[model samples]
Target: MDLNQRITAFSNLSLFLKNFLSDATKCEATLNDFEHLKEELQQVIQTANRHNAWFTPEHITQALSSWSAALQKDNLTTWLDAYAITSSSEKRVAVIMAGNLPLVGFHDFLSVLITGHHLVAKLSSDDQLLMPFLARVLIIIEPGFDSKITFTKEKLPQFDAVIATGSNNTARYFEYYFKNKPSIIRKNRNAVAVLTGNETPQQLEALGDDIFGYFGMGCRSVAKLYVPQNYDFDTFFQAMFKQQDVINHHKYANNYDYNKAVYLMSLFPVLDNGFMVLKEDTNFSSPISVVFYERYTDVETLKAELQSKADQIQCIVADDFSDEDVAFGQAQNPKLYDYADGVDTVAFLLKL
Candidate 1:
């Protein structure tokens, strides 16, 4: 299929996903091949919770909604407008996906296909179902895509280039394994929020979404706080209380209880809001149920420190903090053009 055909197929997949958001059981008339794909997708959604507790129905729905919003015809056209996409000799591109959040590696999948490359994806065990199911929808929408997609549990076959995502440790292994090939090896990165002690309650409340969304498992989740020295915790805690319902999740609550007990036993001072814990720490990556916080004496000094350690940061969120800074509540809602780790996936694929 040509570029326009590929775009139309993905846009159709987005429409199929949008139908399932409100009521997956009630098949919509607009869906093509509605009966078969609808039944399969519904079953996947119904059992996703059983496979991974983090894939709660609400979280899965939110992920689907985000993709639906992103896959609009206008959005896709605008994002791809900057690139000169030409049909070329197709090469196989292997993608090693991360399962930290639902559909986390989809951008890579979309990039490879849209750039006229075949995809050989090794699905993360935690997120094995969704992508492949979506692939099936695409194949049905455009039979030409069937030859372009592959999923495997065994060792990956020879491919021209690779894109892999994992922890810093696994990244080193990928770097060595894929050394002979062109690749993008992603490492662990965390997002942080810089609090000036002037944010209104509304902004702080939105920041809570950045911190607690996806139960704070995704890389874009705000894991640390850079606050002015002597910043009071009362306002922050009160604003975060809006998301107190997170504590009801057994997995999150278990972490909160265990981490709190461990901290208390060690005699480390911590601020708790029943659902979340804040501790004075210089580190960027914090444990689940806990957000590390460090006090900054001056904004300029803090900016320099962050610039020096840019590799460890995925996003810096604040009000006009910098050109790259994400606003409160937008950390998890990145647009199509917001490349991860400042690496351009489309450019990488096009070069291959």
Candidate 2:
């Protein structure tokens, strides 16, 4: 199909979902009862369980909501536009999905889906289930998508745009391999926050979601904190402790086990036990799912530090850092205006 055809198809798909999301029939438990629009999510999550054999039903359900909300056209446009670039002609793109967090592939999926191009997907072994599950859903959404997206286990296919996500380690290889193509080669990034004096217990409680959601594995999740000098750590910890049960979950425990061993081997200092580790440094990313806290005397100092690591961090959580920074705990849950990596997506896409 041509770009126009693909765009028309995607627009239709998007409209269908917008309508379906509000439909009463979409609440059915059985995939068989789900109509075409809902079938993509329904089938994809079911197949995800089959392929991974690790993701629980709860994980599937959570991811389903994540993608569903993300693809809502009004909310998605900002993020979607980030990948929009005018294609010379017929375009094909290869996308590598990240499995570090659940439904991490959704961005790459949206990149390809909105671009009106064929997606040659290389699924992550850690997160192999989501893409395939999504493939089933997309095919259900638009049957012709079977030909648009190709799933592979071995080598990748040729393409115009390459979207790859990996650690700081594999980034060099991605740059070398896809250097010639128009690509968004994302390296590891961490999220941080600027603390104010007015935060209440309720506000700190919300921060727990930014900290523990997805076990702090996602790039969007918070990894560091910048609180005012003399800020009461007691109040912060008090509010965040409401999620103690989250720390007790089995999946979170597994991360605790693996990261703790590495911490032991390296003898790294910790801030807390069995939950999050902390430290202070120039580095933005931290291990063991810990959030590093730094003391800042004023907003200017915090702004200066945030500017230094702009490209390495995701969202800045503070009272209101203007239209740019996201609200704390809202990192994983973005509003319609929130764009990925702070890039304006819709304008990017329209220009493309």
Best by TM-score: 1
How well is each residue in 54-142 modelled by candidate 2, as lDDT tens digits?
Answer: 46556656555655655554554544454435554435777787777666766656656555567788888877766675566557556
Once model 2 is optimally superposed onto the true structure by TM-score, how far is the C-alpha of residue 268 displaced, in angstroms?
A: 6.8
Q: Residue 321 in model 1: shift from native, Å? A: 0.9
Report the Cα lDDT for residue 217, model 2.
72
Q: How well is each residue in 1-352 modelled by candidate 1, as lDDT tens digits? A: 9899988888877777877675555433355568667677778987887899988888988888999889877888999999999989999999999998989999999999999999999999999998988888788778899999999899998799999999999999999999999999999999999999999999999999999989999889999999988899999999998899999999999999999999999999999989999999988999999999999998888899999999999999899788888999999999999888889999999898
User: Model 2 segments beyond 4 Å from truth?
Assistant: 1-56, 76-88, 254-270, 278-282, 335-339, 342-352
After the best TM-score superposition of candidate 1, give how far the Cα of residue 261 lies from its true spot, in angstroms: 1.2
- Name the weakest run of 10 consecutive residues (lDDT summed) in model 1: 23-32
